[model samples]
Target: MAATKKARQPAELEMIGGKSKRQRIWEVIRAQRDGLTCYALSRRSGVDDCTTKTYMQALERGGFIEQSNETVRIGDEKQYRLIKDNGLEAPRLTKDGQPVTQGRSQEQMWRTMRILGSDFNYQELAGLASTSEVTVSPAAARDYLKHLAHAGYVTVVAKGKGRGAGGVPNRYRFNLGRYTGPRPPMVQRTKSIYDPNVGKVVWQEEVSDDDL
Candidate 1:
């Protein structure tokens, strides 16, 4: 596992720009008002037809898309229409049409930050960001805030003291001038942060001699 840490797979490399196959397929579908068949999605989206069909199933069940009566007569080709147009970011879902909960915490935190204003601590961020369906921990919230501060989207207003009843958690404020868009900046597996709002990687971890 340690040896594989620095070694990136081809798939991971492809996702560096945040354009995954599912997202590509979703973009195509959203643009096509008349809808597209699974085969057509494969040809245009660069995703294989079978895999597109699988993704289509989940999207359709999730109410993001609906199947049209039109058929292309190639394989099990049937036209699929996009229903929920939630801007650029593709909806994350499982094969069973369930929401992929892995990334929800970031979304919650980002949304809360916008509504929360300034002088908020990581503990407060976590508490407000968490919903009945999802929970956000102080540690995760602190880490995310650190990246945001590094990226200039957030500012460190005050530093926290040591852990205790007397300890005060770090306070932060969202940089109104740095606000990009609705999408949250994501911390990638490579220790970089990508801002989907600006459609670019905003921050990356510096490489050290030890890593080489």
Candidate 2:
């Protein structure tokens, strides 16, 4: 009988714990105090010229950047200078320069955890971490706690009573000693824990043959 070929897992690209193309472009512009043209930004950041222009347009509208008065030939791409510096974290904006709402909860929860020095239940965490703008549901809090607990970033003070006659949610305490940075340790879809502050995947679950 012929032997069967074994299945292989597809590798993840620069999707996990890596900066976005816009972020890379922003960093390049920030480093170039003199300024850089759209073409130059695209070349240095390894992003396509067209995509760079689109992001630059949004950045210009958001007032994060402005045109630099550098000499250029007729019809040459515009030179840009960083104006409102937002620091290391990339500004998440829509193509139209509108702010995006995707990662707000992650930031809110991480900041709240840093301030709460005592153990708390997931319900309490959700309530406290949430704001009028960004509402963190209990489910979201529970999931975050689960992943962090597995990664040793959070200590489970007590297990929860399931949604039974007298259900009580799990109580957990953040392990400050394990705190990597201000950025939250993200639970990636790849079954991994990515620490943006450290810019690395601190933990990942082992893949099984059955999953291949």
Residue-level lDDT of model 2, residues 134-169, one tens digit each, is 899888888888898888988999888868548987
Q: Highest lDDT: which candidate?
A: 1
> Which consecutive 10 residues in model 1 have the weakest lDDT in total?
8-17
lDDT score of residue 162 within candidate 2: 69
Residue 193 miss distance in model 2 (angstroms) = 1.8
Give candidates' CA RMSD values in order.
Answer: 4.1, 6.4
Query: Of the candidates shown, which would achieve the greatest TM-score relative to the real structure?
Result: 2
* TM-score of candidate 1 on Cα atoms, chains taken together: 0.79
What's model 2's overall lDDT? 0.80
Candidate 2 wrong stretches, greater than 4 Å: 1-12, 15-18, 46-51, 69-75, 208-212
lDDT of 1 by residue, 52-159 (tens): 889989988898888776545655657767778878777889998778998799999998998875679998999999999999998999899999998888898998
**What is the lDDT, from 0 to 100, of the residue 151 in candidate 2?**
85
